[model samples]
Target: MTPAARKCLDQLRTLLRPASVATAGGFRPPSDPVTSWFCRAVGQPGENLPQWNGRPMIPILQIRIDELPYVPEQLAHLALIVVFLDMEDLPFDKPHGEGWLIREYTSTNGLVPLPEATHDFKPFPIRWTRVEDDAPYWEGACALLNMRALDDDEEAEKAFYDDFQRYDQTKVGGYPTVVQSDVGVEDFVFQIGSEEKVHLAWVDAGIAYFFRAPDGTWRWACEFY
Candidate 1:
């Protein structure tokens, strides 16, 4: 690893807390560092940044970082990769029985509550975005790694288009079918923020983590699916 990568890795190690020892009954505390970090970050309420009127807006899912071991044999180096959440224009703040953005509500004829049950609408556009302050860290990390995103790769881009086409063809029904037209992955790395920081998300040993920007602090983690 380069000196820069080593320094980044060293900083990450400081955030990790040692796992609790196993008890006599074979009971062990949660030893997974990524899981521990994720629980704490998500458990606490994050600051909701300001929103704009015209351009698309995505919520910020605040994140932190943890230590990871290097394993070069498996091509498992800590490369920075960006992940994006697909966006859609869905109804929000509708009538009580109308159900929040549920396409299937047609059967109830816009009833606020379909007899026995009511559906709650969460805040619209349920994806996260990076804050303005953290873009430099992300950019620096990407420059250090020298990696390209799937969007920048010809094969990867073609695969995405082909898969999306197949997905569109496979749909059968009409009314409730989710035709997400004008829907696309918003790279918060560029829009509403600096282009330097690539919005990154990666899985290490099956645990999901994201680089929270301004500085690419790798504190947040979760299961991908």
Candidate 2:
């Protein structure tokens, strides 16, 4: 990896570790989908389906950190947590897809590991970077945001959603929601709450991304692609 790329990765690691206080934007549902599914499956008022491809669809959580944690060991743990929560509501088989977890920095050739592991597909050019220890690592890490995308088989999808519905139904209450957006990737703002949160989320595709708030509560956010 270039000295520049490595630096960026280190910076991201710091931001993700102990975590940082920053306005995060992604996608999530106003109502917890799993909770809603359980309620409806058991005959109760639950949240409607998430919108996808223009229809009510499942929302996936995607997190991007401007800063990473100070400790390096904790980075993997934090990333895993984000991955688990993001796919917890989706219908899928594995936690992150079929293959072994591939960790790499985003690059113009695709996703290139620090050591430059051989793989298929060229990397994509990275738009962000950071300086660390006078070396370079990829600016940020990229892993499958949702596990549902792992198995293409319909059975896997069904199993994933079924498990998700069961898990949601068992929870006592719902999680709080947060919303975020950007106009042409310039103007950015976010809000966290109940109805107000939902309305902001609905303005987009209704797909809200979630992350652990500073208070430990899950907050939702979304960006218009």
Candidate 3:
């Protein structure tokens, strides 16, 4: 990691509690199947690469129970895992290439979730544009959720393609689905605040963590890191 990148990571670590590190437990689909496949087709593996410090570019952030407002008895002992990718590692300018693969695993059992259910999670897409808005290598990814309503595979594919096109044209992106890992969180939902931004519902904690840019500035909704 670059000095600046390392500094940013350190700051992030300070803001959040310690992560519950575990191997992603299930066979989830790529947050962006088309994009994931494209990147893999061009050589990026859908599987997590060890090069990224033994984790996917998208690190899993676990929400501590004590920090939560009201923890259900069933969930009080279970930590919530949020998956995110580093935009700096993506190849935004390159066409038909693979991006990072974001996966979810259980720290308790080291089990990967079922691919079908995990793929259903909502994607959080963000585009980083130059001041002139002429650059194209914008970045985005998804969060792991356990909702079932977002499991519509067909709709998810369509949305992803449409969003990918927009990213190619306007340099914008957003999550494509809503269903996430099957860790048993029922209140999970994708909250959209504006046309350009949205966030994954971390209902258990009542606080939605938005993706901030490298400058530590908030992008619009959907406009996350």
Candidate 4:
């Protein structure tokens, strides 16, 4: 994504509160088929999980985007997103939404109560803290500076770039702190980190990055210790 076309994205800190946490966001779907698929996706049968695994899906967390500090114009349609994971065999190498999924809801009206979680991974309402916009890449840096590249000293510019921190945590936006492989500016969405407070762990303290690929398929990857 270019600076003129995209620029930077504002990020929000997504913190997991107590398991008994309550929030204004609705948990249940309004008899939506996709929502039903989410509830029964784990340890059920067919293609997804819940069949050979025989393990229930866990609710990692949920966020009310409409209640967030700010929503990018491109993602205004999203109203809520529920984070999900399985007992084992995550989607590290498999297709997306197989072992982990981020269920996006366009609206929260008329939402009913969700079914009971199969594991101790109780759903926690997310708390958001708005963070300053991050320089997504070199192009973003240029945009923030309001100048074209190549005017500054090479070493100084490199140092300036290095000084930009890669805020790695469960966040709503901003650039991803990739532990392995290269993640670009386009197609990258949000990420879910290992939060021990709510007993949420991904591949042993790894952070899971969710992306909407150019082909429109959901893709997920995690980085662990």
TM-score of each: 0.16, 0.19, 0.21, 0.62
lDDT of 3 by residue, 50-166 (tens): 234343343322232233333323334333323343334432332221332223222323332222212223333232222211111112221222223323454543433343321
What are the RMSDs of all candidates, in order? Answer: 19.4, 22.7, 21.3, 9.1
Q: How well is each residue in 11-97 modelled by candidate 1, as lDDT tens digits?
A: 433322211110111233233211211111122123221222332223222111111221111112222111212123221322211
Regions of model 4 farther than 4 Å from truth: 1-52, 135-162, 214-216
Which parts of model 3 have CA positions greater than 4 angstroms off? 1-60, 64-67, 70-78, 89-102, 106-221
Candidate rank order under lDDT: 4, 3, 2, 1
Question: Distance (Å) between predicted and true CA of 217, model 4?
Answer: 2.9
| Whole-model Cα lDDT of every candidate shown, in order | 0.22, 0.24, 0.27, 0.51
Candidate with top lDDT is 4
Summarize candidate 2's per-residue lDDT along 1-225 as a digit string, tens digits.
Answer: 344434433343343211122222233423321111101111113323332233322221112222232212312233212111112233223222221111212212221112222222222211112223221111112221223232454554343333221110001112112123321111111211112221223233333333333433433333333
Error of 2 at 141 (Å): 30
Candidate 1 runs further than 4 Å off: 1-47, 54-56, 67-225
Predicted model with the maximum TM-score: 4
Q: Could you tell me how far off, in angstroms, the CA of residue 207 lies in candidate 2 after the best superposition?
A: 16
- What is the descending TM-score order? 4, 3, 2, 1
